[model samples]
Target: MDILDWIQNWFKSNCDGDWEHGDGIQITTLDNPGWDVEIDISKTSIASMNLDWILNENSKQDWYGVKIENQKFNAAGDSGKLIFLLGLFKEMIEKIENNTIG
Candidate 1:
């Protein structure tokens, strides 16, 4: 499935009425010509999960970073990395689900 579709499903799955009311996903464009994504994981199965910050910097225009913090999944990268960043979130959830990450 497409990353955005998968993410939408994931978000919908977590929406138990109240959870979606005050907490949800946020995507924005950074002033530095990058994308920012934040998805709330509070009150969900991954609430207590931890993900150390991951950064990949190949060039001024090719870079991305991902991490979990304060019950939210955070990712930021160059404009070209928007989809890649979302894919990372999908992978993170899959790895954690498969017991491949601790």
Candidate 2:
């Protein structure tokens, strides 16, 4: 499936309550000639955990232009940013499936 479709399906199956009820997940283009992906984790099972701690402790791989704040994560870069976001998203979904997120 396409990345967008896969993302929608993932949220549909894994997200609790109405996933689209708020600023849940946002994917948009950036003026810096790149893509941006924002994910709001506050509504997820990992809501209670520290966002910074989660990134530092779990995502060891470096994401240069990514930002995590208040249960939200935003990644922006060139065209490659899409791939990076996809990888991060997949890993998070796996963690969720494995009950690894607190």
Candidate 3:
């Protein structure tokens, strides 16, 4: 599936309570020519979840960022980065659900 489709499916499957009807996922262009993605996880069961992107020295274009809030998480990255970030987010949510993250 395409990245956008994957993202929408992921949110629909993993989140709860009419998430698909609202601004569950938001994407915008940054002035630095990057993409900023905001994902609302307020209704999900996971708590205190966080995801961060670390850039490898060999690759600057592939990176991600996550900002945790009381009701949402904001992710930002360059092109081709959202998919990776979303995967990371899924893992993090799983960990949170399993109570493995401290």
The candidate maximizing TM-score is: 1
Residue by residue across 1-102, what tens digits does model 1's lDDT show? 898899899988888988898759899999889999998988766788778899999998999998887899999999998998889888878987888976
* TM-score per candidate, chains pooled: 0.90, 0.65, 0.64
lDDT of 2 by residue, 1-102 (tens): 767777778678656667568788888986646677888777666555444423322232333366567777666656555876766766776697698866
> lDDT per prediction?
0.87, 0.66, 0.67
Of the candidates numbered 1 and 3, which has the greater TM-score value? 1
> Residue 37, candidate 2: how far off, in angstroms?
0.6
Candidate 3 contains a number of clashing pairs equal to 0
Stretches > 4 Å off in candidate 3:
1-6, 14-17, 47-63
lDDT of 1 at 39: 86
Candidate 1: the clashing residue pairs are: none
Question: Residue-wise lDDT of candidate 3 within 1-102, one digit each (tens)?
Answer: 665676667776855666667778787877655677677786776545554544443356655566667566677777776576666666666687797977
Query: In terms of lDDT, which candidate is strongest?
Result: 1
